[model samples]
Target: MSNRPYIVGNWKMHGTRAMLAEARAIDRAAERLIKVEVALAPPSTLIHACRKEANLIGIGAQDCHPADGGAHTGDISAAMLKDAGAGFTIVGHSERRADHGETNVLVKQKAEAAIEAGMGAIVCVGETEEDRDAGKAEATVGEQLKASLPEGEAAAANVTVAYEPVWAIGTGRTPTPEDIAIMHRNIRAQLVEVYGEAGQEIRILYGGSVKPENAVELLSADDVGGALVGGASLTAESFLGIIIAAAGDDAE
Candidate 1:
């Protein structure tokens, strides 16, 4: 709400209690900075535990089922996440899109469920380097955003969008800042079209290969609100550097 960059660390399949010690370390390292809003999405198994130990930081879940009631064994629903103290949920992550074969339509339903459950939805969208090289990245990502985002235009406060290039995720390679800027700017334009006036305020974070070293450049780029770190976020110091990098008004 403050226009501060909402930096979120996606601890994808990479945290245990000992790792939560690293989360606590993050709490300590970032305690003094009121400039950024930080959140961590751990494995769902750790959400409740994370909620208890969250302390000055926000805790999120990696995924959720579309239905409030379901027999989908091993699937946690949005209501369950809210009950577990998860303040947000990362929906349509690239891994979920690829591994689970989630379609934009399905992701839209899941996001609606999270919003109905009263938690923020970090909706993710991105394209492959191949798509970028072919100059179709913007078109592809724009289509995904059109399909996945709610048509009625949910409030910006309850939502954030993340651009996590499938090619860069976990590959240790990143898009050049210029490309990143163009894509993010494209995304903001699309959002403004879809959400009308409120979309300009929605946080649009850049994910993939986000580390302390590259975070400053990414955070400073136009339309890039923050980051969704994967590997670097496993540690406290690295993740804190990112949060600190995103400090201050993102709109600035």
Candidate 2:
């Protein structure tokens, strides 16, 4: 992947087949910006359709079960996501942890499943506002990364880590550029400790209120390999703005 900035849009629970137009538009724009890698993790319902509609931008699923197939009832497995044309899946997102009660062990299993099914995994880890206030933000995120990442070869090969502060997500708030730089540096150190030289190849992304206006500054931060965008990614115009920011940074 050349370590190009990997800008991924997580549509969350939004998007239907109707939004495929925006996805196609994003894909078209991605084609022109070959210096950056762009991807979208849409709701499961549109994964196949979006994959079918786009040829450039990577298509991914918002979540997936650890098991291949079973009586999990309503839960889609990693294999099914791959079958649906997803090249990747995002696991352990803060929303899944809060709303679905997903534990770190389970997130690790899901990430392993994604690797097993031949898909990339974007594993998320973050701290809450309270944790930040209590001066535990760094330790909390470091612990989550240790617990949530897959083991052995999968750890460095298939996973990308995203740090999204729970309070900042969808709240129109973000860590200062210095704070983001510090966090990413901390994450890079942990990854290197665990995976050795291969860890340097692992992409660390920053999420939470990543808009086009601020994308350049954030993407320029030390060790910030890319972004895991939220609302701003809903529209191609908006998402393309971030991608352009990344491309510009890469050029510089």
Candidate 3:
């Protein structure tokens, strides 16, 4: 996946059957933009629908339960997501961390479950605004990532790390390129410490307020392998712009 940007759209709680049109459009564009890796993690209800519409683009789930089969109510398991045609799943997203009170240990279990189900896991880690203001941004995120990541060498193959500042999501704010670079570099160092040489192969993506207008610059940051987009991904026009930016950046 070297030189190839993995641009993913996290539609969150949004999207219904009506949104399949946008998914189709994104898939068609992804087919043309072979230089970039494009994927979408729609709401669980739409995962099958999006997969049916997607050929080139990957279809994934927003989250998954760690248990393969459980008495847990209202939770979809990683195996279920795989059966629904999802190639990957996002775990430990900031919203999940905050709204659901997900801890680093639980996130790691979720990631391990995804890997066990034969799917990729994008484990998210980020610091809150307070942590950043207190000069603990790097330390906070680093610890979260270390604990949240799945164990074993398989992690280097099936896991991807996404850094999304909690305060930036949907707020239209973004860290400057230098900040992004610094955070990514710190994350890289941690990865290397944990996984040795194989860690360098793991993709560390930037998220939070990622739009087409800034995709190129954000993705150009050192060790920024791609992006985890939010609102802008709900539309083909806007999402395609970011994908195009990634393709252009790959060419460089």
Whole-model lDDT per candidate: 0.85, 0.92, 0.92
* Highest lDDT scorer: 3
* lDDT for each residue of candidate 1 in 91-207, tens digit (9 for 90 to 100): 999899989999999998888889888898989999987898898999999999989985544545688899999999989899888888998889989888977778888888999
Candidate 2, residue 59: Cα displacement in angstroms equals 0.6
Q: Which ten residues in a row have the lowest lDDT in candidate 1?
A: 243-252
Of the pair 1 and 3, which is ahead by TM-score? Answer: 3
Give per-residue CA lDDT, model 2, range 135-236, as digits (tens).
Answer: 999999999998998886666888899999999899889999899899988998998898888888889999999999999888888889899999999999
Please identify model 3 stretches exceeding 4 Å from their true place: 249-252
Superior candidate under lDDT, 2 versus 3: 3
Question: RMSD of each candidate?
Answer: 2.5, 1.5, 1.5
lDDT of 2 at 185: 89
